[model samples]
Target chain A: MDSVFVHKMWNDHELSKMINQDIPFLMLSDQDGSIGKMYGIYDEDSGVETRGRFIIDPDGNIQGFEVLTPPVGRNVSETIRQIKAFQLVRESQGTEATPSGWQPGKQTLKPGPDLVGNVWKVWKVSEAFND
Target chain B: MPEEFKPGCQRPPVKKIDPETAAGISNESVLKEAKPSMVKVGKPAPDFTAAAYGQGKFVNTSLSEYKGKWVLLCFYPGDFTFV
Candidate 1:
């Protein structure tokens, strides 16, 4: 996913070095775009696969899915945040909901039928934004 | 199995898909059958043969050659960039 694409295209020496990497990462050639087609990530008009990340649960169900456009690099930190949030939800029956930009130790709101409109007030903040 | 149609034999009905309204699978059962075809988490990737150019030679490599070891399959649109 790094500059390896250039090597694949230009038939450079780095292609062999990249294929020899030890890290558990995949490098597939999508020249024909068939794999992307099966994943529904291929854009025929744009001629590129959308940057996508899917966190599949141990049971194989798609627990979280994110697709980012090329201009925006993926937020690895935010992805970890989402993973922790989902893990918390799975472990507890707490009715709390993670708010925008909510990280560890950030204030979370207890969601309920009656508290739907006032969920944001749980945080000690100055900005008043609507969801 | 004839290469060309001959005699009075009737051909099977042709199931036509209108190009104007080409769509994905509709039957849940058929989709279920298709579901297993995708690369699932923790499962072996499907076998493929592709030309790998390295060391000034382009040789065909097969997925089976990488068996018993982790493989990473990455793709990019084209080459030559600041990336």
Candidate 2:
């Protein structure tokens, strides 16, 4: 779902023809800035919404989200990484937590009371996945 | 659509109101009145229905309609603005 502060409708056919976006996604027009205000990204002074991205799970819960200033574009790869990490954790029922820079096919940590203070001891920082 | 039709050209023209009437309408007051409560992670997303242009027509859509799927709600400032 994509939301824009301005009310104008996108010419999807023209956009897809230009950008070649094969994926099907819903694009919404928050014409009155209602959704932007609800998401706390609306700038009343400028009458524009700041950049925002939210990853909502199947249950309608916001698993992860990022809000950026108007000038900065978001990282698509990072968003995909986050979604994958969240899905993995959800599949494990909260028993597993992905470490920093975790990606698919990488190792995950089994979160436990015993591992609270001994994270560094149990998981080697050198062995962690890195880009 | 005409060959000259542009993406942003479809927006409705803004209505011009009288200066005195416009002066009486405070944007700040309206903003304060329309401000929405902030949403948080781990909480339910605020539900809304909006008009979306897709597949060559305007369709009414809502957050609840995507309940059984993962949704990436991406909000941008406006159309045709460089990020």
Candidate 3:
């Protein structure tokens, strides 16, 4: 939980230097931990929220969420990969399914009766970890 | 009486569970209850309106405003936390 001023300074001085550009998305300052509590990330004792990430789709439904401790860091590349995977699945109307570690322009599976037991034959372990 | 403090132990007996105190603490006590997240996949994310900083500007932002967009919402412990 930080203030808008803190967010501004952090973004300008720290985040920008690391990424070479400011974060392109809205960065809300949950000073009171109210927003964090709503998302179940607020720690009452620390008065801070756990590092959390939520991917909400266009329909406003939470597609994925992750909460991690201080020592471990979240992955932006993984986030982007999941976003693309979710988008592909949504656009295909659930027909296309992404395997673990799926990336854009990679192979997507068509989920149906044919794919029920033949996943191993078509998708290799190498392809999923190809990237 | 903890097993390690029962006596005949090689190391010094623990007097207190507090690490800061004279007794060296051990991870034996029950911690806080771990509650599951309220936000679930495929469920509607709770709407929130808060003061926000984005792209070098301070503004009031809300979850509802991004209705037709895919958002990768992130929350960290605090500012200057290198995470």
Best by DockQ: 2
Which candidate ranks first by lDDT, i.e. highest?
3
| Candidate 3 residue lDDT tens string, A1-131 | 77899888988888888889997776788887888888988766546677789999999999999998655788888888889889999999998999875788888899899989999988889885755
Whose TM-score is higher: candidate 1's or candidate 2's? 2
The true-versus-predicted C-alpha distance at residue A113 of model 3, in Å, is 1.3
Ranking by DockQ: 2, 3, 1
TM-score of chain B of each: 0.49, 0.55, 0.52
> TM-score for each prediction?
0.46, 0.75, 0.79
**DockQ for each numbered candidate:** 0.06, 0.36, 0.35
Off by over 4 Å in 2: A1-14, A21-23, A126-129, B1-35
Fnat per candidate, as a fraction, reads 0.05, 0.65, 0.82
TM-score of chain A of each: 0.60, 0.81, 0.89
RMSD of each: 13.2, 6.5, 9.4
Q: Candidate 1 lDDT, tens digit per residue, A5-91?
A: 444455444443565643233344556666556555555555666565655443334456565554455667767777777666555
Query: After superposing candidate 1, which stretches have Cα over 4 Å from the reference?
Result: A1-21, A26-32, A124-131, B1-83
The reply for model 3, stretches above 4 Å from the true place, is B1-37
